[model samples]
Target: MGRTILLKMLLFFGIVFAFCTCGKRPVADLPTFHVDVKQRDSASCFFSGYSYVMLETNMECLLTDVDKIKVDSEKIAVLDRERILFYEHDTGRFIGKIDRLGKGHNEYLSIDDFIVRDSLVYVLSAMQHAILVYDVYGHPIKEIQLDAFYKHFDFWDEHRVFLSSDFGNDTYYNFVLFDLRTGTVLRRFDEFSQNESVFFNSFSSFSGRNNKELYVIHPFDYTIYTLTDTVFVPYCRFDFNTEETFDMGKSFAELSDQTRNKSVVKYLGNLIESDSVMYLTFDLFDSHGIGTYLYKRCGQQSYLIRINEDFISDFPYLSSPKGIHGNTLISVLSASTILDIEETYGLSFFRKKGLNKEDNHVIFFHKLE
Candidate 1:
């Protein structure tokens, strides 16, 4: 009887061990879809015959063109509209604008960065050389003076703001963290050097995903940097020296000798998050021309989407291709003339058709496939 009991106990323990060793099955990953929106109008607020708009819930607002006016949602606020506008979801009003107080175009208002809360909007105005806080109704609430031209401002949390500036040279640009509630500078970093002369003509901080990081891009080098409390680190850098399979146009070469070397890193764009993946559009230019490259960041790998020039040349005057709030891709395309390339597949044929308004002017959104 004892021996039989012992054998049964050993068998039960062995079965339990086997079950514990078998771990949970790994979750399957899904394939990412690529979507593009083609704009119908060729001339708008966006510099390259394009416009910037955002879709939220059931409403959309067109920021660039004055003609195609859409209903602005109450949930999103139109913060600023000097050259490039910014919208915040929480405030539901324009946060920053050019101070029209006794100023002309010579003293135009330029907002490089902003942070909005329930009651006030904190703005870093580059041309103004100060931080301006405004109420929801575009009224000035307060101001913080600074010695440098503040280029970009980001929020670390509800109370802290990060600011970046250029000192009229490539190497002197600095980043500072300010306490918004107290109007005090908490930290600053001035050791980093920027290659503004070679690659980036200008730099601005993109909206960060979390409070821990701030992302900035240099257009000329196609490089991106991230700043934290401790240091300014290089995050992702794209070198545009790759062999080109096709050429759209020599847009970069058309700039004057002084501006020819500069490249655009960030225009008005956004980061789209789906499932566990993040999608970002890096608007870049090379000797070939201006184009948008889609990048995907998975758990460990970061790579560019396998899109060809044929896909780009098919739509001339295409501005920033932005991701919608939903799972769609939207962009504004403008041209002196719009063309119909829906039937064309090759790059050479699409360029030959040129711009024909009947085919080109429209805002395009494609469901990611």
Candidate 2:
């Protein structure tokens, strides 16, 4: 009986020791890839743009200055100025528009940002500190008022929303979780660290969204983090060699004011992750160059995707790119760019049902191989 008790005590102690050791294990280092723009330009996978027809109505609305875009399985959404226009994904048919911009009750004075999730559209209004919910047909469902004003926001789930602002200071948190139903602050993470040089030109925060994870990159710091429950854990690191990477010691505002182009670093833009690869697009201001990178996880290899033709030449980089269903990137093209594509490459691939020069726009779809 004494030998049996001794054996059980030894087993219990061994289990406790193993659990303590496992809890103290350090985080593994994230993978880094060095992208050489000049070498990648020659060896790249090229993709061309094809035009899609837009169904016209008596509204006579033209999407001139589009700001943001979001995609789902069946529909594509574009935030054109103050309106959120929905289009059929298979065909670029104008399905509906959400343009309830007013100062009255349940009406928004200005729209800050929007997201389409689960057949519902959530529009954030900074002016009124409210979120207006709508259906796919542009019908009003409900509105939720937030206590604080946020410049940028995205819906995380049915009841939670992630919010951010450029005007954040030491007192203001960089990102926060707000309850959608009651407009109450649930949790806050990451402090705002931008100094005075952030006023000349501002860029949106770098964020990527998949079905299961939400990733965000710090502006001043080059660290990418993923949201896990209530905290953001570091996910990956971007290395641009010794000379090309941004100086983390100085603020971006300071770098912009002091240096012309010599000390300025490459700006990180939109990032999206797939099953086997990660897609990121950035630009170089000193040399006026834009590059899209794909990092494959199988062999841990990264490559720069150079669109050979002037597919998106009108914009500096892929502006407001959204990862649609089937792991594809989709964006809306202006009417002028559609004409340019038609002139350069013949219209055999395009279906010009009711598309005209100044009235209709094209939908650009890019599939990864």
lDDT of 2: 0.61
> How many residue pairs clash (N, CA or C atoms closer than 3 angstroms) in each of the candidate models, in the order given?
21, 1
> Candidate 1 lDDT, tens digit per residue, 1-369?
999999999999999987754432222322333322221211211112223322221112234341111112332333224432334433323333323333443233665555556656566666677777776455667777765666666667777777765433333656777776777777876554432322232234453343356665433333345666655655543333332322323232332243433453333234545566665665545555665655555566554542334445423434444324344455444333223443454333324645343332334444332
RMSD of 2: 6.0
Worst 10 residues of 1 by lDDT: 39-48
**RMSD, every candidate, angstroms:** 14.5, 6.0
Assess the local accuracy of residue 295 in candidate 1 as a C-alpha lDDT between 0 and 100.
58
Q: lDDT of all the models against the reference?
A: 0.46, 0.61
Q: Which residue segments of model 1 deviate by more than 4 Å? A: 1-108, 167-173, 193-203, 218-223, 236-278, 286-288, 297-319, 322-369
RMSD of 1: 14.5
My TM-score estimates for the predictions, one after another, are 0.52, 0.75
lDDT of 2 by residue, 1-369 (tens): 999999999999999988655423233656555555444532224233332335343354567777766777678788777888887777667788888788865567887777888888888886677788998677889988876666677667778888875444343676788888777878887665543325222245536776766777655445567763466666766655423444456766665554455523345555667566676655444344433344333346656644432344422223334334344555566656655566775552333654456666665655544
